[model samples]
Target: MAVRMLINGVAADQVPALDRGLAYGDGLFESIRLVDAVAPLWSRHMRRLVESCGRLRIPPPDTMQLWSEVLEVTRDMPHSVVRITVTRGIGERGYALPAAPQPMRVVAAFAPPQVADSAYAQGVRMRVCDIRLAEQPLLAGMKHLNRLEQVLARAEWSDPAIAEGVLCDSHGRVISATMANLFAVVDGMLLTPALDRCGVAGVARAEVLAACPQTQVGALTLDALLGASEVFLSSSVRGILPVRSLDKQDYPVGGTTRQLQQHWRDLGLRWSRADE
Candidate 1:
């Protein structure tokens, strides 16, 4: 089967054109990886989604109802990706807010992408994107609807060999990968970029931080990243993917990266070849 979708608890494939999310990108979403028919980091995803809703002033959906809808759509699927979207329902002609706004809830499930076993066992190659992320403090760290930056950065490459792309902010500070969070092992210290200026704070990134409490979150420059002994990317869908090379720079799969992969398995979110 292909992708199954539901809109506002109904079996539908599309939303009305006037929906605020369609008109103005006014909404929040969470992409969760379901393994063995369960979402391992569901609570973390929910927390972020609720926080983002609060930030955007979009009334949060009922947690229980949302989960039920997710389960309903993903039922019988052993491995899949479930995306939950909450949008401000159909609105008036302008940017003005509706006095009694109704929120739309969408739950969809798709077959997970088939990643080669080698891509996980032996690190994957990446590239440095020419496009840079804009610094927006107001929208930083939240997975909001506007994603033109990521769309453009991802369009920079179409080569199948490059597993991901490293994206930096306007000031040359490394923020994250096109679809994941960035992390590096520098001189025995674990470091990840601070998302205050920009970037989505991924759920897998939070798991890494929790596993390694000593992780330093701060500004990470391109020089700092290239100089690191090990580099890895994390996302809710693909857990920890060590970077074998970025552009012409080479990186080893190293002990630190493997250890972190183990940490992910310990958290009961196992899908990587490293777990095998």
Candidate 2:
């Protein structure tokens, strides 16, 4: 089925070419999964989007109106990936904020790619990306429009066998993956990097931390990662994916990892069913 898009409650085709989002990367976006006509993590995504807009000084659209637009765009789609983007609207040719700012909101729906359930069951292989994430505390956790870093890291490998890349911060401290948050089991405790310097605080990462309050968040070095008993990556789209190896250093999917995976699946199923 063809994807559908809406801009400010109108057909996406009506969007003006002068939209700032197309000219400059002055926007925030959310990639959410719509199951049974409901976006399970809609609230969480909206909260983060609003926070990102506040940080970027972009005026936020009304939440109720935005939700209405999302429903309008996805009304005919059952299971899909929903993308919501908000930009600073049309502006003069300058970096300065427009004298009278009007935000533009775009909501679109696309078929989500088919993922192998076994990948989550058996775990996935990962490589340590040589490309280090530059420390930008201001953009640390928001899903902003700038993503050249991830694009560069992902381009480093074309081998289909490798599923993801583990990234480190500019200071050589392990941060996360190109598209997900990293968690490891060290000394029988779950450890994830502190995202103060870099990395996105993924929705799945937040869920895992909420589910397991004892999970530790702190600075992690490559040495600690190499010596860890097990590792995994988390994202809203991928859920919890165990890391079978890092940079050819192998480790079995630990018991704790599996336990968390099961918990995550249960939560996901519940969320999906709740939308029914």
In the predicted model 2, the residue pairs found to clash are none
> Which runs of model 2 end up more than 4 angstroms from their true locations?
13-17, 269-276
Reference-based TM-score of each model: 0.97, 0.91
Report the Cα lDDT for residue 268, model 1.
69
Lowest lDDT sum, 10 consecutive residues, model 2, at: 267-276
TM match of model 1 to true structure: 0.97
| lDDT, residue 153, candidate 2 | 99
Best by TM-score, which number?
A: 1
Model 2 C-alpha lDDT per residue in residues 110-177, reported as the tens digit of each score: 87765566666667888889899999899888887878889999999999889999889888999999
lDDT of each: 0.89, 0.81
- Give the distance in Å from residue 156's predicted Cα in candidate 2 to where it truly belongs: 0.5
- On the 0 to 100 scale, the lDDT of residue 38 in model 2 is 70
